[model samples]
Target: MSTSVADYLLDRLRAWRVDQVFGYPGDGINGIIGAFGRADNDPKFIQSRHEEMSAFEAVGYAKFSGNLGVCLATSGPGAIHLLNGLYDAKLDHVPILAIVGQTDRSAMGGSYQQEVDLHSLFKDVASDYVHTVTVPEQLPNVLDRAIRTALSRKAPTALIIPNDVQELKYSPPGHEFKMVPSSLDLTWPQVIPDDTAVRRAAEVLNAGEKVAILVGQGARSASVEVQQVAERLGAGVAKALLGKDVLSDEIPYVTGSIGLLGTRPTYEMMRDCDTLLTVGSSFPYSQFLPALDQARAVQIDNDASLIGMRYPYEVNVVGDAAPTLQALLPLLDERADKSWQADIESKVARWWETMDSEAHVDADPINPMRLFSEASPRLPDDAIVIADSGSAADWYARLLRFRGHMRGSLSGTLASMGPGVPYAIGAKFAASDRPVIVFEGDGAMQMNGLAELITIARYWQEWTDPRLVIAVLHNNDLNQVTWELRAMGGSPTFIESQALPNVDYAGFARSLGLEALTVIVPDELGLAWDKALSADRPTVLDVHCDPNVPPIPPHATFEQASNAAQALLRGDAEAWGVVKQGVKTKVREIWPGSSS
Candidate 1:
């Protein structure tokens, strides 16, 4: 009746306050599965439909909860399936620990079933730290270090346990030679940049009449400080996609988002700024930033490696966003002239008006922008929004407004698909009392979202506040790639590659006992959101949207415009619709008050 390695591992996770593990079972981890049964699910084993989804759910949990996310998977194919999601966590800099089962030790070097080399497989994705536990004594130290490394580095880590080792009697690392003992407690230090660096950054900010501030997810805890700094410098703040909710969109001086899926005001601010102060963001698109000689820039980030990257900076301050900003604020001088602030506010106001006009534009069926626009005002103050990569991200970025305690995220760095529904599921587990919403394209839904709905149905009733809504843009096309081909490649829509098979997303939701609605027109979007948000359980809104609606960039280059024109001229499958929708959507920016 002694504790097995599997039992001790679960106990250790519980000791670390890990209450749930998202995973799918396989024979490779039969010993661990038996331990879960014996432990009576104290640290609940939340089974995902697939191993990839499990990793994604853990990432989502980590992101929203601001804690360590742990995922489990069987070895071989199960381990391979987890790479994409693990890469998502790694690239996004989320803290996740992946515990994967390996083949039995007796079969080592024998090429047995499910005996792939896991260490090599995970070395790249979990390069921060990846280790295998060969003996019962090695379990505690390896598991503890994996958790500590994932949290400290803010990256994915891995621990591989062989089937034979998992069933062996548990034993602790003693005071014997060659034994490495570990501790559970870890206190994060408050990192603040030296006063000299802060002063130099302040001087750069003080000299410029036109200051531009960019914030990323690293600024999440420093929203107040970011605002104070922006106000002091008379700057307009722009958000990286990962930092969308760092500051409220309701702030007059805050530009919506930066880069391709960004607003015109943000693009113009970066283009015209004389001083650039980047806080906790590594927005990769250098083209969207100020020209090399145009501005003096300063960047503050905790990670020294990412500080001077993306853009050259006059001063790089290595520290946490909140404390660094706090240090810099005292040295900053408040600008008496409010002209730059006034101009930014004016542009921000006009941009919202343009978004409204674009949302109301007529289309073949539903305008995709209308779904997010209508949902924005109706979202709960504490709701968490998750968007999948693709066309849905376009609307989510430009149209939706996040304020109050509301939070939102996507696969920002990796830009992967099929994590929308799984992320939502994980968010619910992270904050069971808060409502969760997901914006997904039909292509993503078909890829993995539909199956995750069954996972939703299996656990929705357990939630204290059961309000999870999934809005699927049923455009019947791989819309994002379709637009990319026209804009980037100067190629007409390749029907075979762009078109998607029609699926009854709403029907599938209803079949799983969840409330479902299908909206074929724009007017129904508002009511659909209202119902879904108030539903006692998870709901799906399958809105048929126009695939030809172009996701035009805020500042589309002449080359991009020319390429798109060439695509239509070459006889795109929906050339006429594309032309009509593109013109209608773009005109709203020129004449915000015009109805036609």
Candidate 2:
């Protein structure tokens, strides 16, 4: 059997069981894109509005589906656009394969138009595996290596095929490309630590009176095992942002999140713990973690190099989260005392009260926190939510309570904006039967490449249940950066730089042939959510939010207070209002029995 290199590549992808490919067309990659069209039903080629969104949608697909994600792009700028999302997948440890186009082999070293060294450009991002196929014969081995390396290493891999080479005749020596078995699905092997390491970890955990567990995306598949360990040790669980859905917020022992966007329960749990058990989280914030001198620690991770990279640990169990915990569970003595856990639960209760007060505040304009809390219940139990960076993240991280089968994520390490809408679109493709929801700030909604909502509209009818919802928090301001300036003792000057022109997102969605709604009142948000979810196709809900409300830190430092005071002195009305409101709320909480 004989085939062109481009068709052979698609055949190998089919052999690897890759069902979807996201990308944009360009002159350099016209041959490959044409091959995609001719490859029968091997893979669904999703046309994104921009190459950046194509890459981001691929990242989202890998994140939600737990499978290999593939995206394509033409030479030069088209290939360059994939770096951001590829880096996101690399940093987050997701498997993705980028099939990039290249200038013709004949133009090598001549610097033809649109000729850029993609190999050199992708060197750092796709460090694990980066290669190009200069000839037809090299395609088979390189394709196998790229896809296998991406799946096994859980990172992004790149294959740059020249334009002329993509159309070259290809016939392998022994095996025919089309006859290769597509039934064998490759999966990463489950690694378990040795008995000695497991015993040492259990011993360290057993010695401490107060144990706290910090989990990340690495521990996602081990929820049951993590909960069992937490329960047996009477430990409090604090999840990293990437691991938000690992344990539901309603779980009495599970603190919502860790870091600045973390809950008070998580902060207190880490601050007072005698022992810390880290499971698959390389949380970057050292300040948010337990001090090295304060707590003895045990760390479990599949990557041995990342075990003690974040913090010092007495025992390092280098293995998969679930398997390691499964081996260590029987070696531990169940904790008999419950005082520490009870104290943490009490603090969580009070934190909920504070959050509720913030979420249901009666203001003329809707509070963003209130929007998240009120609208959360209306979301489907199994909904996959993606929150964009900025103030919207502050609200989503602090408010949305994951229960039942619900899950959510954001750009954890990249922390980039503009991926929310693309992420939701990618997740919809991964979980076509479930409702896919996104919470993005107006600033992000207007950012470059978010027009891929039109891509969703294009393929809306292909889905089993395309219940995709885009909920935009319309404050017309870069609320997070403004709050940061105030918190850092700087005057909120040059307000023009932070302000956004009002966008009628509902109208925008409607114009794109999707159901849409706009609401200014807080009470009306629930109905908007209901309408969005009930609609058969995609929907967008734009809620007018109060710009005056601040996303106060979970545990404010003295310097933060001083900065707020300085901002107030600088005639910042929002800052002054925040301080006054915060003080009054604290007073009421501290003195509930007082007559005054």
Candidate 3:
């Protein structure tokens, strides 16, 4: 009995516990597609509407499950389509493996039909590792190495299998590839450093009276340790967007996100802090960081390359966040001064009050913020929320509150749109028992695959548990980009380019056999949410929202203010209205006698 190279590859995947492979079929790689049919129930093959969606779904799987996500594509254009999604995973530091089929080995360099130079094409995207299997003997070794590299580096890896090689009979190597089990450990051990580094970090942290702690996605598992350190030092906690779910709003001194889509309290904490401790996040926006002259910093990260790279730090603690915090706990002195923490809490309280008021602002078209404020509290205890890029992401970052075992993530780093729906589709399968909800913009839905509603419907045919919901912010424009233009001192004359034609998203979903609802008023929101949650199948809620609402940055510059004035002079009333609202909100936030 002999096994095909495809069989050996699939076997290695099963051994690595890859239960799902997302992709589409094409002419260049029919052999592996045949193997998929023979794979039976061991590893399910999910067919996506497009190759790009397949890769994005793989990224979603890796992000949500903390495991290596796998996707397959045929040669040439098919393999090229995976780049955008692969870059999404690469930039976000999630582990994902891309298996691409190639034209026959005999077709090299002669411009054969559908042939591509995959090796050079994937080099930059899969900088961590990329290899092509030239022979049957190389099949198992190449597949194993690709997976290991993706896991160890927390990045994307590519394996190119030529069409001819996939159908060849597999032969046992005369000598087996060396296996170093310890080197390939996937347990994610919390690597701690020697006492000297911890002591140095503790010294810097203990010296400052006004300490602030900023957490990122990498510190998600260290929630308890993070809270303990913040409590002992009486420090204020602020989160990066990726770490929004790291600490809930229940923590008194915890300010929300920090940056353009951030809260005022977080901006104030970052600006006023004398000492800063950053955990596991390499947040790229340097403007939001505290000034070097004002603050001394201690940075904790497992990747030494990232330590002190974003800011000037007095101590670089190269270790896992949880154990490093645990080791540094004893070296800190308890600060008796409670003034800094108290001030931050007061600001945070007021910030929340302003947020509540803004969420309910009266407008002809429903305000988008109201959906998050009113619907978030009603979500299932174990809901997995995914937000698309654009205004939906801006609102979700600031307005949605995560509590009690709930988890959430967006297309961080790349900030790419169109992944919201596919991510939710992937998450629903990854956490089958938990409910999955998506907040998507109308532009993003049209850009990605609105037809993917068919994919969800296809999968739902096999499952009895109803567990997917999509909430579409049905504003007929790319509102986020429009705001960015206005903030950057540009005229809104070209706003017409970002506008989208009115499409009935709920009707489209209903056509696919999924339950659907459309609402135009704030009062209909709750019942629509209720119906979506209780339905026995996938559901979509299309809520019309005012596109004039601006995603105001935490701080605005003089030039930006001038830009808004210029637009208003040019008869751009929408820009004038949004900027007016922004100014009004800022006044309320800073005025001494104003309520939250």
Instruction: Please report, as a residue range, the 10-residue window in candidate 2 with the lowest summed lDDT.
Output: 587-596
Runs of candidate 3 with Cα error greater than 4 angstroms are 176-188, 461-465, 573-596
Q: Which candidate, 1 or 2, would have the higher lDDT against the true structure?
A: 1
Candidate 3 lDDT: 0.84
lDDT of 2 by residue, 117-139 (tens): 88799999999999998867677
lDDT of 3 at 166: 90
Give the alpha-carbon lDDT of every model. 0.94, 0.85, 0.84
Considering summed lDDT, which 10 consecutive residues are worst modelled in model 3?
A: 176-185
Error of 1 at 325 (Å): 1.0
Backbone clash count for every predicted candidate, in the order shown: 0, 0, 0
Compared with the true structure, what per-residue lDDT tens digits does model 1 show for residues 1-596?
99999999999999999989999999878889999999999789999999999999999999999999989999899999999999999999999999999988999789899899998999999999999999999988999999999999999999999999999999999999999888899889988798999999999999999999999999999999999999998999999999999999999999989999999999999999999999999899998999988999999999998889988799999999999999999999999997998999999999999999998999879999998999999999899999999989999999998999999999999999899999999999999999999999999999999999999999999999999999999999999999999999999999998889889999999999999999997898888998999888899999999998889998999999999999989999899999999889888879977875
Best model number under lDDT: 1
For all predicted structures, in order, the TM-scores are 0.99, 0.95, 0.96
lDDT-based ranking: 1, 2, 3
